[model samples]
Target: VGVERTFPVHTPVIDEIKIITRGDVRRAKLYYLRELRGKKAKIKEKRDIRPGAKAAPAAKAAPAAPSEA
Candidate 1:
């Protein structure tokens, strides 16, 4: 998770495996899974620390002015 690797999944020709999901891992590895299982194997759910991260801001919305006859 936190650690970066060079030869872990190195490819010389082209392709290898397909990643299904990219987890928001807190630690370098999920080594705790060896002993823990079921409920204990679960990691704490991570939340967005960024403000207004749910959606992107509207495209610079401006106040419309009333037209005169």
Candidate 2:
């Protein structure tokens, strides 16, 4: 049997996010094996940030040419 549960996690980069954890019921105990691993991988990828790094600036649009009547 399988069970699913929702957990709220707070992080600096993501603020707060709800993660659904799944596990298998064995011997009346829930064993969460894959859910934790997957969550860790996802959070690692998202939280990969360098300190003192700046984001690239967006390009500005060119001014439209004056319409000649």
lDDT per model, in order? 0.63, 0.45
Output the number of the lDDT-best candidate: 1
Model 2 TM-score is: 0.16
Candidate 1, 1-69: lDDT as tens digits: 344344655766557777544556677977676676578766665666687654544533555789999
lDDT of 2 by residue, 20-46 (tens): 543333345334454565444232123
TM-score of each: 0.39, 0.16
Give the winner by TM-score. Answer: 1
After superposing candidate 1 on the true structure, give the runs of residues whose Cα lies further than 4 Å from its correct spot: 1-26, 57-69
* Ten contiguous residues minimizing lDDT sum, candidate 2: 39-48
